[model samples]
Target: MTAEATTRAAELKQAQAALQQGRFAEGLAMARALVQDDPGDGEALYLAAVAARYLKDYEAAEDWLSKLHRAMPEYGRAWQEAGHLALARGREAEALAAFVRATRFNPALEASWREQARLLAAAGRAAEAAMARRQQERLARLPRELVAVTNHLAEGRLLRAEEICRHYLRTHPRKDANHIEGMRLLAKVGIEFGVLEEAEFLLESAVAFAPDDVQLRLDYIDALRRRQNFAKAHEEAEKLYARDPASPVFRSRLAIESMAVGDYERGLELFDAVLQQHPRDPANLTSKGHALKTTGAREAAIAAYRAAIAAKPDHGDAWYALANLKTYRFGEDELAAMKEQAARPDLSFMDRVHIAFALGKAHEDREEYAASFAAYDEGNALKRAQTRYSADAMSAELARQKAVCTRDLFEARAGSGHDAPDPIFILGLPRAGSTLLEQILASHSQIDGTLELPDILALAHRLRGRRVGENRYPDVLRELTADQLAKFGRDFIENTRIHRAGAPFFIDKMPNNFRHIGLIHLILPNAKIIDARRDPMDCCFSGFKQLFAEGQEFTYGLREMGRYYADYVALMDHWDEVLPGKVLRVRHEDVLDDLEGQTRRMLDHVGLPFEEACLDFHRTSRAVRTASSEQVRQPLNRKGQGAWKPFEPWLGELKEALGDLAPREI
Candidate 1:
């Protein structure tokens, strides 16, 4: 670490020790000084809140908590402090709500659970109190270190969690010949870190070490799913189902995995099997809706979503699912009901976020542009707070790609690595029309469509040595021998073969792969790449209004989204400069104007014949798993082309971020 960083760390440590020593005033001053020097320092903000709260400076404590929330909204300890502050001021009801929020953010917060139990009991809600006590008791059984690890994981302090979990595993080696919980916790950290292979291995070993441990098997299945190993996930889920034929969890897992593998009929059957036993299961109902939607059963999907909402009136996922259809128009009653649910302080954190996005779509559909923007902004704000994604860091990373992967490096490594041209990488920013391009290409008989495959990203992660975020990626590409590159390319093909049919060519539409063009070219030199480009405003605003299942944290804010788009464009330009004619640029607007022409261009680039089916792509029957599925199912139109115009009033930050790249009209 730098001298300045080392000093700051020591000061923060001293402040922490002061708090432990009951020197609240000294700790508060020290933390406030740190905060003044680095306003975004999450640790300093949290310590300041804790110290201020203990000192009974309620207003200052509130100020620190609010800043901490901006820095780390999902920080359980911060919310716990907020609960304490409210209680100190005799606001018992608010304290109860804050405690509930704390537990939701980090279930390992035993104090929050204890307080919740006491408050619920005082309110004479015996059943709720009993549930809280059970939760607290369950947490009490875990090792204190593990609880701390869980808290760090939940609060997105991933590196800290990984450090603690790894130490625990090292110190407790051979204690159980399995150490299931420690391994499982480490795997959870791996999943959070996007180190899926390590996570999958850990969970897989844990499951084998204790086959009857249902939680381990379920986590193993989740790791498999995250790796896009749908077939393997289904197999694991089936084992759980075998253990208990009547368990809803197993049935639902099997159903979801089955759908992932395109066994929609079997998936739907399994879903129905569970729903019949418990008709009001909102999660199952929502999953069924997703399955139906993927299979082009639009009306049936709508019904399933509506059923989920009816079963659980406050289920924001169900509400968002309906809005995500893009074509679904919300009715008056549905909007009011959603507003009521969103207004509830007792609502879950994610539920509130989901409802905000759903409300955005509802208002947008009604042409209430200002209200639409406000709701979308609300949801994005919540997400931005949670993720704490840094656009500057992202830009720096992409810049490293440009600096390391120069033309000379490509020339030196020319004619090496795998020679197979079987893969077609349709890559760019998310919401940049990559899905539509994939649909067009996959309509051809020779091309197979796949989900946004994680194989490339996983391979990149594998190359990033032990220490991540130290700029080891594209630089490491220089050290990889030709044989190593070829082997990696071969492994990629073999591992991803599960997602492919008999087609000779397949699409891997992972948008983030644009940052790794150098890595892709080094491994699979003959692979074809298609750059899906869209107008900045349309793309950024579309992304802002949508709620993705995971990742794409940049889309949570207009400025972040715009900056990311600019970085993507710069990176793509670098790729073009270094590897001319390697990537085919297909603009979304160009496609809308001349679908057949652009389709022919992409086909020609990939050495495929211009089939008429590519023109009738919307009519082609295939499972599309993207936000654009509904839009892509029908004919291409200008309906979505200028969507940002209505919300232009609130998009100044986006335009400012885009600068010269922002279109004149926008």
Candidate 2:
């Protein structure tokens, strides 16, 4: 740590100690100083808030908590402290609501659960009180370290959560009961940290160790699905569904996993069954709309989305799903409903975010540019606050790849990997038309279109040796033996086979794989890699407007997204220089201008004979799982072209970040 940071850490420790010892004045002074130095420090703000609450300075406590909550919206302790402050002023209803929010954010908060149970019982809500007490008992049964880990995870401190979880597991390895929960918690951290392979292995082992544990099995299924083992995930889901076909949770899991494995009919049927059980269930209705939307059931998808909105007007996901359809136009009632949801103080964070982005699209469709940008910015700001993305760190990481994956490294490792010629990698920035290319290529008889396969990303993560000082990923590529590299390549092929059928070659359209192109070449030298490029303005702005399911944190801000694009371009240029004739750069606009020519070129690059079906890509029926799924299903058009023009005045940050790479008009 820096000298200043070390001193600040010491001060924080002293303040915390004082607070624990009932020295509220001293602790408050120290915390206030720290907050003055760094107003965004959540811990400092939390300490200040707590001290103020203890001192009965309710107004000051509220101010500190407002700052803390804004800086760390999902921090359960902050909300717990808020609840305590409300109770100090005899606001039982407010305290109850705060405690409820606290538990929602972090179920490990036993105090929140206890308070909720007490408040609910006082309110004569017997069932809610019982539920809250049950939750409190559940937390009491678990290890304290797991509770801390869960709180850390809830507040987005993923690295700290992993460290505590690992230490706890190592200290109590043979305690099967504790071990299983620890492993599950570690797996959750792994998932949040994008270490999918570790997460899958951990969850799978936990499941094997406790097959009767329903939660473990559910977590295992989630990890498997994230790792793109759709069939295996579906198998696990099927087991759960068989165990209890009437369970809404199992039924929903089966429905979603069925969609993953390309059984859209079955997924829709299961969704219908769930709806039958609870017809006004907003989440299920929204999920059904998603399954319908992805499978090209346009009218059905629209109806499902509207039904969800009708059932629960504040359910923002259903509203966002309609907006995500890209071609769906919002009616006045729908627009007003979304605006109402967005304005609701009680709306959940994600629901508010979903409503904001949905409103952004709604206004954009109506050509209300300023309102559109404002809503989009609001949603992006919320997501940005929740994430811990660093553009500088990303730049440094990309630089390491360019530095370590040199021509000499390739020359020395020549012929050192498995000779896999059956894989085609479509990689680049997310909104850069990779889905379109995959659709066109998968249209060929020999090529299979798959979900954004996670195998390559998992390999890259494995290459990142440990979590110490600096990451040793592309650099570690130099230390890996030929056998190890070959095995990695072989394992990737075998693991990903579940996503493919009889096709000789399949596309792994994981856009972030662009960051690990060198790793790809080192492991599978003969695999075809396509660099899918798009117009910077359209790509960056589209990414900015998007609320990704997860990851791609850079897209939550215009400047960061633009900077990432520039870094990506520079890294790809390095790859071209070092690995000449190895990557084929395909521009989205060029493809639009000459579809048949580009199609033939891509086929030729993969050594496939040109087929008419490649040109008739939009006609090919397949389940696309990306945001651009709907767009790629229709015939070619410039629907996305110049989309940023309407918001050009508000895009100075993006233009400045893009530097000379941005369009002259921008």
Candidate 3:
């Protein structure tokens, strides 16, 4: 070989060795030098891109891969490298397209097909996933035992997979390739089946056996997070971050875990650190903005949100954050931008809801009732679509659990004689005008407006022990004695007292408070319970469109949403039956139809005088976090009452489930 060729070969070998040893910067320098000498070499360019990706230099990786693709369009390795680069940068569509190209170029690439299937499944394109699965099936045949065990696991015949894995472990007695694969299969089955305990144990064992495996550590973190072992998850995340401090993915994971455990300060710091390295990361920017908003840095939060939008024009969460920030830091110029973004048809369903909801509030603030109602209608429609697809038996079960939580809660309060401070609660399905009711009540001078405090739900979750399923409530309640219940109630009051700010009364307007009405009645027998009832179709459909953090699976499926809504009504009816004269049902339509009459009745029910301010609730200066923020800023209108009309033609499936769009009670 010539001297130049020999030197290039030597440098390429050294680069590969450097990369293997995690000396990414050193490897990248050498790889680029080798690539410059051998521009036609696909392997060199691929290695350069891999090094760039490892260094988290997404732009460099993209540039390198783009040139490689241009130079050798049919090169399977270039396509595969591009796919990896795309996935690393969170470009799923680009990744899938590249993977498709790779498979086309080299049909014999078994690993490429496997990765293609995994990516498609992750993206929720089940048909595409099935196609990739077929490719894997056609490429190679597995041993009968492996195939049989995999099939059994897929079918949730876990005992068989366990037996096979155990036998394999016993016979192998070492981490052979087959044994490792079996363990991996075991972990996969556990995760897919939601077998938390088994998944946790298997992941722990896997991590122990392969401590250096990043993927294994990630899997273990996922299992622990699912189990709500936040402390352990945070520790694992910290350890992972220490291994790769510059990895935005690991940093984000740590931030998320910290936020989950109410460590908002630490979460914000971590998020800020992530943004420092990746200033254009829209997700990190949005998260940081949200953390700021929650931590009371309202103006700074708005600025961060704007920065996020500037970086990623289509970042919906940034739009939502800006809209929320405008609540206390109102701006007329920003309103137009908020409205425009909220109405963008190209936005995703959840983004559309957020934008619409924000725009609605902004329009309402300007007293543009027609525009506000239109925004609300669009937002509500998105929520309905979500409920149609996601809600199921799980919602019913959750609602039941919530009701039991309420019962035990109230039973504890029964002996106090005095209702807990801020006894008035507004509860119903979210987007059902609970916020509007709170705004109206807050205008009463007697009531303070506290945006949804999750104190009650948090308290209930804390009281729960090692039990699952529907029947766990009664047994759980039996464990809370009167004294303990009073202490719990007192604790709830103390936590929320900050929001009350010395007001004689405050509206704890958590829409999900419907789940805790039983507790509300028992704790404060005299506490007014306003059940904000909207048209079932409108409410359920609106819920479907919303992307809530919890208790919203029913919103994803029409049948599930319908049944869940029915159960919610049934349980509320039961509360009314057992408690008698406690709940005052306030129809959204009725509130719209006769604002004065409804306002008077609402005030009277809560033992307040009929003040003119109650009639002018739209002018109240309180910050609302609910989707109704916009609508409540305007005078009452019927535009939202029959909102299901435009989408009425497409809601046949839902109509069949709930038997019409008209308001109904079980």
Candidate 4:
């Protein structure tokens, strides 16, 4: 560590020691000084709250905790302190609620769980008290160091959590319980960092060591799903369900896996069974809505969303789901209720983000352009602050790809890789026309539509290795033998088989796959690629207005989106120059103007016979999982072609970023 950082750490350690030794006054003074130096320091704020609470200054303690909670909602210690303050004020119910939230945010909080059990028992709630006691007992089995690691992980101190977890794993024996827990914690950190292959490997090794460990199996299944290894994930989910057929959690997980693998009927059946036992479950209701929406069951999806809202009025996800439908309009009462809930100080950070996006959509539908932009800006600002995205870094990575994947490299590795002619890749920016293209192609008799699979991205991450400062991926491609490239292609095809029906070809419409086009070429030499293009202004603004479920952090800002789009165009142009006649570029406006002609052109490019059904893509009934799901289910129109006009006043940054690439007219 640097000298300044070492000094700060020493001071924080001294303050912590003072608090531990009951020197509340001294600790409070020290913590206050630290907070004054940096108000955003979560650890310092937590120490101040702890010291004030011990000094019997409940108001000051709460003030500190409120700031901490606002800044870091996932900090379980803040919630625990709030619970203690509530109990001191003789508000047992409020204390119970706070403790429940504390434990929910961080299951390692054994004291919160014990207090929850005590409060439940005092309230004569025997069943809840027993459950809380069981939770506390289960947590008590974990080592104190592991519990601290969990606390740090929950509070977003990932580096510290990772350091402690790795130290534990290195020091402890393999078969020890603490070692197993350390593996799970480290795997969790990997998952959060988007290193799904590493997480899958860690959990797989841990599960092999203890095959009967249920939690380890569950974590493994989750890792599999994150890796887009849906077949393996389904197998693990089935095993878990067989072990306990009556478990709602297991059943729900199995149903989600089923839905992911395109077994919609079976998924809905399992979801219904779970709802029979817990009718007011907002999460299951939302999942059910997702399944219904993807399967083109519009009315049923709306009903499910409404039911979720009825169950929990502050369910911001349900509200956001409704707004995300694009076709759905919110009533005045619903809008008012969402605003009230959004304005509450006690709402969770994620919930507030959802409400802000939902309100933005609601206002946009009402043509309140200024209000819509404000809400969108607020939501994006909140989300952007939490992300670690850097536009310059992304640009640099793209530059590396351009530098590495040269014409000579392609010539040297030409004619290698698995001879898989059954894959079609539809890739581009997120708000581009990829989904519409997928829908059109899926209407063909020989094509199967799949979700945005992450196999290529995961492979890129794996090749990059665990370390940061090394550029191992595109450079590593040069060292791979022909057999290795073929094996990778074969593995990708085998892994994605679970999402495919009995079709001759399948579409992988992952937008981010555009970044790995060279990787795709090296792996699947015979695969077809379609570059889905849209008008730059419409595409960037549409992405700016929308809130994606994950990734696409660039869309949080207009300049970022525009610059990213410009880089994308530049890289794609380079690809065309190096890999000519390989990618078919389809324009969104041309497709809308001449649906049949464009459809026929696309089919011909893929070496398929022209089919009339491609023109009637809206009538095709299948799972559509994208922001444009509802829009694609309807006939083509120019309604969305110039959507950026209404918000043109605030799009100068986007236009300036696009430079010469910006559209001349709306």
Candidate 5:
């Protein structure tokens, strides 16, 4: 480190020590000096606020906290301090709101949850108070080290959290309480790091060690779901439900899992039972709306969303869910109500984000392109700030794949994997018509349609190990034995069997799988690969405007989306060169112009017979789980062909990123 940086760090530590020692005056002086050196030093500002609050200098505390809030709106500690300030001033409502905000930003804050519970009880809101108490109790049960891990994880310090978790695991006895806690914490870090396989293994081991631990089992189920091992997730969910058949929470979880695995009728029935027991539950109503929407029951889904709104007018998710249908139009009153909620200072950050996206969709439906773009931009900005995604890092990763996955590497590993050939990978950038293609293929009698399964991505992440600074994936492929590759291939098929019906082939339409084609080829050499292509402008713009439920963090910015699309194209071209004629490229526009011909081509590529049902894919009765769920449920149209024209004025970043790849016309 530089001399100045070392000195600054030492000084900050000294200031923190003074505060911990209750030397308020000395701590305040040090904090002020630090702030003077760098006004935007968030730690210094936070320390100053804490010291001033301890010294009973209310005005000074308020000033420091205001600066901290301005610099870091999502900083939960600042909001917690603000709550304390309000409480000291006897503003119970303001204190409650601040505490709620603090917990929303960082749920690991046990103090905030306790304070919220107390305030809710005082306000006579018994149900909410009980919920808050439960949350606080959950945190309180964790060991100090795990609590620290949770705090670090909440603050986006995954490496620090993992370090603490690993230390605890190494020091604690196996199968003991502390060790189980450590395992859970480490598994959480894995999930956050996108290493789902490791998380699944850890949670499964933890659950086996403590078979009766309900929370451990629940965590296992979640990990299974994240890895897209739907069968196991469903099995675990059923066990949880069987343990407490009358528990609405358990029933709700099982219902969601059922919907995930395409048991729509059973899911709807379970949701109905939950609604019967708790008629005013907005979350359950919203979930029911999702099940209905995915099953192509648009009107029923709309009614469910409206019911959720009626149960709780400020339910931002319901509003956003309706907007996400891509065809639902908000009424004037609904739009005004959404705007009011969006403008509320006390609204949760996620709620405000949902309202912003909903308003964006509302404006777009009315052809108010400027308003739509502004709202969409605001929503994307908020979501982007919370994500740890780096476009440059992603580009570097893709570049590494190209460098390592040479023809020689593939030729060396040729014919070494499982020979099942039951998987068809429709891979490309999101919003690039993969879902449309999947819908068509799924319409065929021999192919089963599934959600974007994470098996390939999870395997890739597992191979990278748990270290923070490592790129051990495509390079590690060189070290794998033929038997290991075959095992991985077999594991992928066996794990994904939960999402399959009795079809001979199933489609794995994860768009990000484009970056892992070499790994796919190495493990599942006989797999059918289809490249879903689209107009760059239309595809990137569509992705930017869509708020995906999870992943696809690259879509939050126009430049990131464009650059990712370009990277995808370059990698796919490399694959074409190295594995010639192995992957069939399906342009979305070609499908729009000639659905029958492209349908036949895709079926022929997969060695399936031509079927009239493939052309009538929209008429199929399967669950579609994507942003384009509504759009894909209808027949092909020219509606989205040039959808980016209206927002052309603000697309300079995307256009510049695309360069020669940019569409000829705006």
Candidate 6:
């Protein structure tokens, strides 16, 4: 209405247009002029900060935000923006402090609350994350839509919450703040939908609307990690790390991505440093152990595991790692000493279980079946009694998931002429040396060991309306057309190029990729499917003792691990029967029995020449990030062959399940 106000509004519009076109300097100049005229204007300060951030002038952005905060100390957005800019510059500790300050200033700021939760989750502070989520729910009034939606989320009613969020967005069309909330909810829904691409798209849009929103930034990072875009995820994490240099979270994440990208040594050092700063950090300690194992420092790795166990006696992963080292990497005397230590009465039930599992495998490897049975029997008692899952329900759910994935992968590509890539899929149960095999192959001149990828799972999700673990595929057949497969194949190749930045052949070594063998075969008939089979008991017991942060569902129980392995074997056998030479069986025992022989055969199968380095895979020195990291750093060993024997006396349940060891004819 006023002449001056109209002129200011026009200038603001022009400034916004310039900002939209990324003319940061010009837009920032306009924003400063507007703010100078009205120092109390929050919007002008916000715009100036945005422009400063765009120009990579973090100090300027902070100055603008500080002015806003000084003007209104209780201004929650100001604190939130301070956190955002801090996080953007990789200052986690400061970011955390800022976010906490924002939430303290205004608990009603749901966005700020979620940002804290997101950062906590990114930092692996699950309990803190839960607390934040609960606080968000508590602050909302009931019969309140947000309460109902969040309650549904808490109860795993993802679809209901999603529908509600979508409905809210549709009804409240013009509110940018509410719209952003709706998008955030939709992204969560997409995660539950197991649609990585959809989740990715929704979150990407959410970030576009609120580019400086810390929670949205974190959500974007998670989506990237889920899609197995480690390179990009690491890049985003680098920004976050810059925001909080002292934050252990940044180091931990960098370590994880470094490991993923085959920078094990750097990852190890970072993990070790994090553990040093936060001495009782179980995950960092475990990861550090893995790095040690990878570097062939078996004893040192074991010490780390032991220290982790000492810090947290019930630490399942530490126990598992200790056992693995004793059985696979240690000498007979060291094995005896370690087992004696594990058998101490002070050990927790989980530790005992892990020890038994490890001891059994060790005995079995020494061909002492009776001793192995004893250890397995002891471990089995605790395992069978554990109520981690209801067996019948899990069976049904797993069967349903398998059926859906099978239909999607098999029928959808039944008669299609899609020629798959090298399809060098390394499949087996986790902790069964799949990563070692990949590293060996990858070290070869022709092969690239791409990290544990989720491409097949992502592709499967897109094809069916579900994830690899969910049953949602159509019953009817609809083979992928050759052109479609070609496009998908090329996209897959291009997308995964980051993993194999400089290799001729790339490996998609998702161990669980075993479940998608049918789909893989259909897509890439010529693809070399390397069935990386360790001894059944070794694989089963190994998985049982470790702790995995992601995607080792079968590892929580002995029966579950055993049954999954059985299913995997059955499936691989079917592939052998149906596709014949399309699959090559790489027995871990044989690989150990004569490393050179196995290496030569492995190379021949993958269509590569035998390089001496393949024989000395231990000396290759690339960072390995698997349970077998330590084992691979040494020459092959016979000690792992029948390692289940010592615990055989304890394996009352699994003994029947796995009736006999398949003869070592390989």
TM-scores for every candidate against the unseen true structure: 0.84, 0.88, 0.52, 0.95, 0.90, 0.62
For every candidate in turn, the CA RMSD to the true structure comes to 5.1, 3.6, 15.7, 2.2, 3.3, 18.1
lDDT of 4 at 530: 96
Badly placed stretches (over 4 Å) of model 3 are 1-281, 284-307, 313-316, 319-418, 467-471, 478-480, 660-666
Candidate 4: tens digits of C-alpha lDDT, residues 1-666: 899888888989999999999999999999999889889888899999999989999999989988898777767878888899899889999999999999888888999999999999999999999999998997799888898899888878788888888898888898786788799999998888777777888999999888898889999998998777887898999999999988999999999999888889999999999999999999999999999998999999999999999998888889999999999999999999999988776678888888899999999889999998889888888888888889999999998889999999999998999998999999999878899999999999999998899989988988997753445987898999999999999999988887888899999999988889999999999999999999999999989888888889999998999999999999999889889988999999999888888888889888899888988899998889899999999998887878888988988999999999986764
Ranking, TM-score, top scorer first: 4, 5, 2, 1, 6, 3
Best by TM-score: 4
The Cα error of candidate 4 at residue 76, in Å, is 1.1
Q: What is the C-alpha lDDT of each candidate?
A: 0.89, 0.90, 0.69, 0.90, 0.90, 0.70
* Model 3 whole-model lDDT (C-alpha atoms): 0.69
Tell me model 1's lDDT, rounded to 2 decimals. Answer: 0.89
Global lDDT of model 5 = 0.90
RMSD value for candidate 3:
15.7
Error of 5 at 243 (Å): 2.0
lDDT of 4 at 594: 88
Name the lDDT value of residue 434 in candidate 2. Answer: 98
Candidate 1 lDDT by residue in tens digits, 283-390 = 999999999999999999999999999998988899999999999999999999999997764466688899999999999999998888889999999889778589
Locate the minimum summed-lDDT window of 10 residues in model 2.
462-471
Clashing pairs in 1: none
Residue-level lDDT of model 5, residues 1-666, one tens digit each, is 799999999999999999999999999999999999999888899999999989999999989988887667678888999999888878999999999989888888999999999999998999999999999998898788888997898778898999998988888789565788789889999898877777988999988888898888888999988877787899999999999999998999999999887888899999999999999899999999999999889999999999998998878899999999988899999989998887665465677778889999999999999999999999999899889889999999999998999999999988799998899999888888999999999999999998898889888887887665665887898999999999999999988888889899999999988889999999999999999999999999989988888899999988888888888888899999999998999999999989999999999999989999998988988888888999988988888889999999999999988887997763
Better of 2 and 6 by TM-score: 2
- Relative to the true structure, candidate 6 reaches a TM of 0.62
User: Backbone clash tally for model 4?
Assistant: 0
> What is the lDDT for 10 in model 6?
92
